[model samples]
Target: MTCQRGWQLAVLMFFPLFLAACAQTPGKGGEVPSAPPPPTVDNAQSSGDEAACRLDDIQYAVGMPLGDPSSDALARQGGAEQVRVLRPGEAATMDHRPGRLNIHLDDNDVIEELRCG
Candidate 1:
């Protein structure tokens, strides 16, 4: 029938236009857009004398059990203004702080490593 032919012709004509509309246009100068840059560590706290945490002084705390008294002493020894204890499978912020001490503990709650953030 003519009506059926008209519908088929209309679909054939519009299908290419629909596909062209969905096609991604090249960016400026015909170059594809690049992915965003990876995040960089914030250095605002590590500038000059602002870094008060010293990991070398608190390395002895590694392999020890993290108790309340020991945690306070370790923070003092490391000259850290803040202390963060991270246990296995625990979520922690990625932000780095030069004056903060990060204590990583194993599944047994024993200190595995000590580092200055």
Candidate 2:
């Protein structure tokens, strides 16, 4: 019928426009959104002395259990402004900070490595 043919023709004409509207053009809605900036270290939590963190001083804590009462004391011994305790398979930021002490723990909750980040 003529009505059927007209409906088909209208669909054919508008389908491309619908698809074009969905298409993203660069600098319009097509541009990839920028990634958020990396987090900034909180100065209030830092000792403000970058040179205070000494990895060698806390090397002895490598084999110690994280839950031990002395663990906190040991971390402070390194004079780091911030202490980050990382467990096995834990995710941590890669940002480097001279005053940050990173304590890498094993699966058994034991300190595996002590380093300055």
Candidate 3:
């Protein structure tokens, strides 16, 4: 009888402990590690670690300080706004490459003339 009682108590304790153990993924500073935000992203005030991102017209933040593509139709339609990721320590050689913003990305970065600049 005591053995049966012991087994029941053990089962209860074991389940909760197992679940708790599986609950949290760890990361630097115990900050509950999260995925690095998508390389391409958008923000409200046009700022942050985000790479060269589109910010209506003349105001945009290029985190790593680089140039990228902007949409033609978008520009023609007056949306002239879009941005692409330009990681840190990276650069792009852009020219009057027509409606498409032609930029040369670094080794890792690609020459993606994404509709988004």
Candidate No. with top lDDT: 1
Rank the models by lDDT, top first.
1, 2, 3
The list of candidate 3 runs beyond 4 A from truth reads 36-117
Query: On residues 22-67, what C-alpha lDDT tens digit does candidate 3 reach at each position?
Result: 9987778777877677786445544533244233442332222232
User: Which ten contiguous residues of candidate 1 have the minimum total lDDT?
Assistant: 43-52
TM-score of candidate 1 on Cα atoms, chains taken together: 0.62
TM-score of each: 0.62, 0.55, 0.25
Cα deviation at 70, candidate 1, in Å, is 3.4
Better of 1 and 2 by lDDT: 1
Candidate 1 segments whose C-alpha is farther than 4 A from its true place = 1-13, 24-52
Q: What's the CA error at residue 74 for candidate 3, in Å?
A: 37
- Backbone clash pairs for candidate 1 read none
Q: On residues 1-117, what C-alpha lDDT tens digit does candidate 1 reach at each position?
A: 999999999999999999999998889999998889999977654666555698888787787788844777898888988999899999999977778888899998899998877
Q: Which candidate wins on TM-score?
A: 1
Give residue 108's lDDT in candidate 3 (0 to 100). Answer: 51
Q: What lDDT does candidate 2 reach at residue 5?
A: 100
C-alpha RMSD in Å of predicted model 3 compared with the true structure: 15.9
Worst lDDT window (10 residues) for model 2? 43-52
